[model samples]
Target: MSKEKLFKVAFMNQGKVYELHAREVNQSGLFGFIEIGDFVFDESSGIVIDPSEERLRSEFEGVLSTFVPVHSIIRIDEVKKRGNNKISDLPEGANVTQFPSPIYTPGKGKND
Candidate 1:
C-alpha cells in the first residue's frame, strides 16, 4: 500500500490570494509558468455551503490543467490532508508587492 501525495498551493492574482489543492505541482515547459493538475475538493461534503470553494470549483470546472505565472505564486506546501480551498483579499499593510507594470510603451519609446 502507498500513500497518495497532496499539495496546497497559494498564489496572488490581481489583488487577491488564491489557495488550491492538487496532486501534482511542477515547473511547466511554458516559460515563467507553473503547471498544476489533479485538483482535489470535498465534493460529497454538503454540510456547509462555502462560497469561496464553490467559486473555485466553478472556475476550474472541466479544466484538465492550468498554468500559473511564477511571479504570482506566494507559496506551495505538501499537506497530509486537504483543507477548505479558498480565495481571499490581500491583507492591508502587507509587505509583499505585485510585479510592476511596464512604464514605457514598446513602439513609442521615451526618446520618440
Candidate 2:
C-alpha cells in the first residue's frame, strides 16, 4: 500500500502567519507565486474547539487553489502525518519582514 503525501506550508498574510497542510505545493506559472491545493483540516473529534483553527477553516472553505507570493512564504515541509492547522499572529519581535511592493509612476521616464 502507498501512503498519501502531505505538505505543511507556513506563510504570512495580513500581518498574520497562516499554517496549513495540503496535498500539493508547487511553483506557479504566475511569476513570484506558489500554488497550493487540497487544504486539510482537522475534523471535529471532541467538544474542544479552537477559535483560531475555526477561523482558518472558514477562511479556506471552498477554496480550490491558492496562490501565495513567494516572498510571503515562510517554509514548506513534507511530513509523515498532518498536524493541527491554524492561523497565528506574527510573534512579537519576529525578525521576518514583509516584501515591499515596487512603486510606479504613470508616463514617467526610468531616469526621472
Candidate 3:
C-alpha cells in the first residue's frame, strides 16, 4: 500500500481528524456512525474500550456512545509511497547469496 493512502472517516461522537487505514481500524460489534478521529483503543493504557453506552459515558463524555459498525465507514483512500515492488519482481531462485559485512569485525581481535 502507498504511504500517502488515508481515510477521512467521520467521528460520530467528536469532531476530530485522524488519518488512518481501513485495515488499522478494528470493527467488530460496532453499530452507528463512526467518528473520524475517535479511537477504539485507549492510547495511554493500551486497552480496548468497549463501544457501549455506559462505557462511553465513563470514558469520553458520552462520545462513541453509539456503536458505529465498521460497515458504516464510507470514505477510503490509497496511500502513496516509494519503492513499492511486487512480490513477483523480487529476486528468487538459487542465485541468492548472503555476504559478510566488515562492520561486524572490530579492533583488538574482537567481533562486534
Candidate 4:
C-alpha cells in the first residue's frame, strides 16, 4: 500500500456498483473485504475491474487473510462493452437523409 503504487481492486458482494481510483486501495478505506481476483466486472458502470475480488481472495487468502463483505458489492452483472444506446437502431431508408443537399440553378436570380 505505497503512495507511489496504484491499487487495481474490485468489490462485489451485495448489489451496488462503485469504482474508486486511488494510489493505495487498502488505504482508501476499500479494505475489510478480500479481493476476489485480478478481474471483476462492474455492469452498472460498464467498467471491468482490473483486480477482481474472487481471484484476490483465493490467491492472497493466506497472506492478507480476509472475507468479502456481503454489503459492499457495486454490481450484479458485468456491463456489456457496447453499452445501452438511447438512439434508435432501426434501418435507414432513402427517405431518411440526415442532411439535404442545397439546390443550385444556373442563372438563378436572387429575386427569382
Q: lDDT of candidate 4?
A: 0.35
Candidate 4 residue-pair clash tally: 17
Best by lDDT: 1
Please list the residue runs of candidate 2 whose C-alpha ends up more than 4 Å from where it truly belongs after superposition.
101-112
For candidate 4, the TM-score is 0.21
Give lDDT tens digits, candidate 2, residues 16-112. Answer: 8899999999899987799999998888687999888899889989999999998889999999898988888877998777967743446668776
Give the alpha-carbon lDDT of every model: 0.89, 0.89, 0.33, 0.35
Model 3, CA-based lDDT: 0.33
What TM-score does prediction 1 earn?
A: 0.83
List candidate 4 stretches off by more than 4 Å: 1-3, 27-112
Output the TM-score of candidate 2: 0.83
lDDT of 1 by residue, 1-112 (tens): 9998999999988788999999989999987789989999777767778999999999999988899888888899999999989999977898776875543446767777
Highest TM-score: which candidate?
2
lDDT of 4 by residue, 1-112 (tens): 6334333333432232234222322322343343433332233543654344434334444553234453443323333232221112224452432232333445768777
Kindly state the number of residue pairs that clash in model 2: 0
